[model samples]
Target: MSIPAIDLMTTLRSGHSTSPRLTWYGPDSERVELSGRVLDNWVAKTSNLLQDELDAEPGMRLGLALPAHWKSVIWALAAWQLGMETVLDGGDADYLVTDRPDSSGRHDAVIAVALPALAMRWPGELPAGSIDYASEVRSHGDVFMAHTDPSASVCAIRAHDGQQHLHEGLLTGFAAPHEDGVRLLVAAADGLEAALSNSLGAWSSGGSVLLAHPDVELTDKLLAAERIHGK
Candidate 1:
């Protein structure tokens, strides 16, 4: 059976235009917010960087090894926009995206992302052939046009214990209602399940996400502060 492809970028654009879409809180109380249009711009730039600079194409698997930062969410959206598969556990991918030191993982192309929202340069020296994501992504165009229809299979979420599940799109993988104004708050360890559950639930529903790092001690306090409606 042929899978019906739903472009993630298209879905995001069709949502409310001026509302806040994504918010991130770091361990040290740093915060960043993006509206639907701003988020889409980041996605487009990242997608273009992947396609033009990293040679990403539909059906290619890109390893995502970063934490649940806002940039990681942007990368996930960009990968799906390009019709590329996201591999969450650093396994079986053509390229690896990681912010970890020594980020030259097994992939031929490595995108080293600096997690600090304002930082322009990667703090450490990456191995040969590793590209700094922050430095390279913004130089690419701010709009992306896919070369072909995206396949239904959008991502491969691998658990730390070696189990894997493929989803049509990251948002569709969850049972969250795709309704409007459903703000979600997440405070779990940085992993595939936690990342997608919070991000997809909000994006699919025309809502927003307030992602808090696991190190943040007061989950309820943060949620209330952010006016989050769901966990």
Candidate 2:
């Protein structure tokens, strides 16, 4: 099913914000406020661009190379505001460019993401049929806004075919709100404890989630993630 077009600012004003919701943990310092301001600006700019795409197609899916940084959280939220799907990948996953795997029954435009510097290894390319996140969003200019609604949902999980499965869903059910009756497909990635905790929290609190693990196989994905990424 397709999502509905929404005014992100209006959505936040109305109580159904789609901007990504993030909880950055850092030592108490001055940079926190400074970083928050910069982040808010970036999110504001990204939100408008995504909102336009979502306005055009509520069911649009986006491939996201989720960097292990605070900014990644904001970028994911912007996509949610537009009601678009977000496919998560490793920071270096962009290297999968030539080998972008074809998993979803649908197609996606990959972006060459500029990830934050970290010790973790990055994905070399995007999936089989995706675009470069960095190239796509690099030149896009939009200052962010602080006051935005960040209530939409997006997440990623590993699929059976060695591909990623991204999922999205409505924040409110039309007939039965939060009844597990409606689930939006979203991005895919190795299961991260923190990410799942956040996604599940949203699902239970009447917010959208990135995936639905009604089957046992889905749990295996989490195990695999732990095996690979768990230090």
Candidate 3:
């Protein structure tokens, strides 16, 4: 059976490969934009790193102990594409992706992610056993091929509230509603779950998302510059 998340990515890649799919406005006057093809490339590389290096597979639990940033979004998408279950809470997991390496000792594997767009590697030394995501991810393949296909009924996400969402209903049941082709603005302050839900809704409808960091003021000029249609 085809995974809904992977299918959505395929549609995004084929439909408008050059159009901006995700735009990020972060602290320190940082701005990053990713077109559909570029977004897929990042997801593919991350998926490859998870699947090949960490032996990730369907049914494996991948915990994300990170905030609602672009890197976190990519990690979720990568986990889904590899058929791994994404744990939003600090639950038990086979692998944990986090910015804080100190608290990730319990997981079997740890991936330390850097939030800066231009970071070539983690700023400081990570935990002895943790992998540096920014450093290693770039070396992986730009395309990913899953070793096994996941069933539609397989668990896709484990929410912070302990609700389990299946692959078949991930987007249909959880995504926030928006009009077709709506350029939605997602506030990172709303949390990771909301970011994922809104992004799914926007992309699934041939739309795009603009993610603003908590510190970035949502000014009228910024909204106009980004052509935001809804929040």
**Top lDDT hit:** 3
Q: lDDT tens string, model 2, 1-231?
A: 322213322333234333333333222211111122344445555665454332323334555444333445455555554444444443322122212344443333333344432213235754454544444443445553323333334333332234443333333321123333223222223333234334334433434433322232334564353222221
Q: Which stretches of candidate 3 lie over 4 Å from their true place?
A: none
Q: Rank the candidates by TM-score, best first.
A: 3, 1, 2
lDDT of 1 by residue, 1-231 (tens): 222123445656566556778887776777888877788889899988888877778888888888777888888778766667777765688988888746435676888888888888888677777888878877888778766766665444555555444556355544245456777776647565566656777676667877777777656776788886556
| TM-scores of the candidates in the order shown | 0.84, 0.37, 0.97
- For model 3, the local distance difference test gives 0.89
Instruction: Report the backbone clash tally of model 3.
Output: 0
Clashes of each: 0, 47, 0
True lDDT of residue 157, candidate 3:
91
lDDT of 3 by residue, 1-231 (tens): 688889988987889699999999999999999999999999999999998999888889999989999999999999988778898878789999998887436888999998899999999878789999989999999888898887778899966676788988888976778789989999999999999999999998899999999999888888999997445
Span of ten consecutive residues with least summed lDDT in model 3: 99-108
Model 1 misplaced stretches (Cα beyond 4 Å): 1-6, 101-105, 153-170, 174-180, 188-190, 219-222, 229-231
lDDT of 2 at 165: 31
